[model samples]
Target: MTSSIHNEVIIFSQAAGDTIHILDLYEKNRKNTKFSIYVIKNKNIYDYFNELDLRLKNLVFIPYPKRFGLYNIQLLRKEKKRINSLFKKHFINSVNHKIYFFAHVYDYLTMSFVLSLSKNNTVIFVDYDKYDTNKTLPKQFYHVKDKMLLTIYKYLVGKQLVLTEKKAIKLLFENTNIKSNKTDEVSSKIKEKYSHNIANQSTGNSVLIFETPTAEASIINYKNTMIEILNILVKAGYKIYIKPHPYKGFSPFLRNYNVSICNANVPGELINTSGFNFIFGINSLSICRLAIDRYGSIYSLIQLFTFRRLNEKDYNIKYLLGQSNEKILFINSLNHLDKILAKR
Candidate 1:
């Protein structure tokens, strides 16, 4: 270390809401005199992180227009040259023994530029490519493509960090064809378990965080389903709190229901502090895993919302995901929930 005065950590994403939580964590860490951080932003998603109280000696925000015009395949050669130039000017300067780049997802563009600037020193790669709810044809293509890109990513990046999920790990292996028996499963479990405990300790009627249908661009038949479930929970005489997906925007469907819709950003601390039982959407199994000790997967509920069939492979996936056979709850609708609950 050459008494380096500046250290930079660039986070690449347009979705500031999720990444801000990571930045908040970095801000709270113990500070040393050796390194300072410059929080780089692309697409101008800097406002969310700016609001946080950070003790870092310096923070630099860089925002640029995403290469919207270059989405066409025919323009990639020209686009590649232009992108290279921009990366050299803006992103390359941040690479040093004192500097690091935290690529949020398997963004090929960001990763490519980082590799070009990479030397023998410090470059920390953080991969946070969680599942997306959008089930569109175009997005599906991108998802498969991203898998291949991420595999290549594991080799080039100085460090590969992933969330503790078996499906994600399997996907990475399938995409990258890289067999590493050394793959580390870093758990965000502390946060999740702490929140679970908080929810249990709280005194009040339980809150039910609903995964809205229109997450990403796909629509699930949620209106009727949520209504059906709420009626049962209401009849059970439990007060309900409802929280929607952040990107799904405000839900009008919840207005007529007996549930209270929470519109603000409810942090993990609050989720831990507040008592709530999760009523899952078809795709909300992941979030519910963070809440309770166990989860009941309604395979029939999946059939109710999705036209796609849930086969043995789907159950195998769920089983591989740490859920036992008994934990899987296959029900047609809320009406069937009463019979299931009675048996429980």
Candidate 2:
């Protein structure tokens, strides 16, 4: 069958970050290659994938069941064969298959197992969407349980935890690194969709808010917590705007408050972040890069919440991610935000 010189099969789940960056890489570096994207556990966000750049035609979804533990190499082989079958379904006839992943902790597990199937094939890792934390698998998962899980995943996969390049020695121990900083393509598209001028959006004191529903299990007083932020902003006489996560529906609030919802596709980074005094989120990692870029201070309330439903390891991961990056400030309470804002 006639095809591009190289055939790449990218294993990614989320449409927003990693997948978008992969498209950006393909757009910038037009290597003569045909490719397909394999999504893991994509049932919920299947609709969200459509919003990605229209270049990729074939998107295959492979759900990871909880029963198949991390150490199951045989199960992984079975999954890869299913993926091969998926390739057949798509009639993707190219032996030159190089699997690509963004190399976050969990998705790395999926991509590594897939890479193991083709032992000789090259596996590429990108750090497009992951938060630039000093933390990674080894550092984050130093505890016995997580360490054992990561170890088992590596052992079963058999492929080395190769990061981006020679300069990214730190990421060798970590999971991801700064590879391609091409969030522009996706950001531009989002901006075009929104088309709201930054000046128009922010007339006076305003702050952008992000609500991560995925992390709500760990968040103790979800509604009250959101209300608390809104209340604080209201008392400070700040006009509040919320950009609800695509997965997490907007939190319900009485229309009496000045708080409003943003339906635009604009990412926090794309927005004129300088216009706002502060940016707030509940464990939403997407805005870290933007927070770093803009002169304004960014804060997170992840540590303020309780995680009764979530495991201790998972809860700790969220806590660490808050203080992990210098760009974002992790506050345990709304009261703490006053001092930081005072400095600003």
Candidate 3:
């Protein structure tokens, strides 16, 4: 269903769970106009939003979580119906402003629902590349099929407002004609030109980002992976520093690691001027490229576990890791990590 008038814009995102903070910034920037966010909740979105104080005085955030996990077609259809119902209940029939729908993930279920309900509305796909680092995928959710869905969504969506050309290349080149050489050339140039404005480095201490299942399904084994990475880097005389993926939920487990955790408020100026190296989970492409241009490597523990999870006969871990050289140096199990890093 379309929004009532031409005066408002609503951001439609999956699980008001993760993106509320990001939307807060958007709401602030567009505060002059009537802007609302419709967050389709799957879990306990209200609790999460309340905990974070995501409720703003002007920006109306709707938490619409379904009671069931839509694992099959029947449930998916039901979920679609539920989402459509919410949009109609909230937006359709109003006449003051044109309604805009910003789809964040653009997955099949959500995409299908939006297409059906868009009837007379403007639909935009968010999740710009400036936000992506193209390093890793979340473990608890997401699948190869989602990648296919994203390809389709990009084709159908009105516009793609990516952060950087490098990110655009990464998204378009997933299975296209954009040559890796050309992409790398553009990526390097972008970093070189923009480094002065965006690049941040740590001068004295370094932080290792241990992103758990929250970062993506590809790199969920946080404990063993973190230990292996720390042990190897420690042996190499690197001091210990750790932080969670900015979007990852708070962890009591990290206390045991004796590390520091940071959030969105941490100034990019601080990271840019401090000369710190971010060893992180590559959920966003910008972070991966940033690390490569500044730190020379992206230490993603998830990549190691993902390789192990792949069918041994189907893919050679060493060869795959070797080919993905953008910011990756090596992917290894704990037993072989030291030996591999020794060679690097």
Candidate 4:
């Protein structure tokens, strides 16, 4: 059997951040590759990609069962069959193609389906979040059933799994049987394409805030605290813009404030953040990315609100911010936030 000269690239992405990373990969390999993106059915993600100028062909949307659980053997089997059918419809003779699959490592079902697609294919797992914060096996996966599933997943992927972070590579090496030599970081070509504009500096007195959905779980009145912060900025004459979480559009309460609402469909990292003087978020990875890139004066509101159940992930945001060469400030209280705004 003769193999096609062109490589077939399949991407399974969940959200805007994933889409940005996929875009970087697509732009780099669009020359010799036939690309197909399977977006996990999300209204916001679909809308975001739909608005892009690229007008990508072969974009497929697949439904992810709302109640899908890893341990549910029946559901898992059904889902696997459904996804397999989708792949069969898309690729008539995948064996004759050099297939490349890109997906998040944490998505076990998607990974399983990709593994079943083509035996000779390459699988690259992409994670946009901070590597130190993300765990391949979470605490919930400590159960016997979950452990068995993870073990099976590890074996199926074997040495084919490639991650974007060097820290993640180390973690996988230390935690799993996956060897360091087997895994590699995101290619320098893709990384260069993705971060080409990282050096763009921030200007003007406009402040961009990336809103988080975790506010509902906070001990303090999240709305009130946000309103107070907005009030301070407004009174201090700083133009404020709020980028709502894609999953949870604009908060109605925040509309009352004198702040512009950024298109929630767009990933915060993709936006031209250099237009703003400051960027704020409650431990958002976007803020961390911008901070590392030195796009603006980054600040974290994590210090203000106490969560009912704070975990390592929450603290890791702080660590990531600190890791950046750029100085990122932390707002400890309403008074602290006020003083910081005053100084700016």
RMSD of every candidate to native, in Å, equals 8.3, 7.4, 10.4, 6.2
lDDT of 2 by residue, 1-344 (tens): 64444555544554444544654555644466555666666453444455544456466666665566446778766655665565455434444556566653545435444444343344555555333443433343255655555455555343344222111112142233212222332455543343334435766788888765555565566767667767777777788877766545565553456776764344444455656777877666556655555424677666667765647535445543533345666676677865655554
lDDT of 3: 0.41
lDDT of 3 by residue, 3-95 (tens): 355655555555322243344434445545555545443333333333444434333444434364434556545655665675466655543
Q: Alpha-carbon error at 289 in model 1, in Å?
A: 4.8
Ranking by TM-score: 4, 2, 1, 3
- TM per candidate comes to 0.55, 0.60, 0.50, 0.72
- Looking at model 3, which ten-residue stretch has the lowest summed lDDT? 176-185
Evaluated at residue 255, the lDDT of candidate 1 is: 77
Per-residue CA lDDT of model 4 for 157-220, tens digit only, reads 3433433221121113233322112122235454444332323233457788888656766546
> Count of backbone clashes for each model?
3, 0, 29, 0
- Which segments of model 3 are wrong by more than 4 Å? 1-7, 14-32, 40-66, 69-81, 94-113, 126-204, 214-222, 233-242, 245-253, 264-275, 282-286, 292-344
Off by over 4 Å in 2: 1-4, 7-15, 31-35, 42-53, 57-84, 90-92, 104-113, 127-202, 248-258, 263-274, 306-325, 338-344
Candidate 2 overall Cα lDDT vs. reference?
0.54
Candidate 1 vs 3: which has more TM-score? 1
Candidate 1 residue 26 Cα shift, in angstroms, is 2.6
Q: lDDT (CA) for every model shown?
A: 0.43, 0.54, 0.41, 0.60
lDDT by residue for model 1 (71-177), tens: 35445555555557766665554534433344334344554544554452344444333333212222234455455544443433323323222212212222321
Cα deviation in Å at residue 120, candidate 4? 2.6
Which model is ahead, 1 or 2, in terms of TM-score? 2
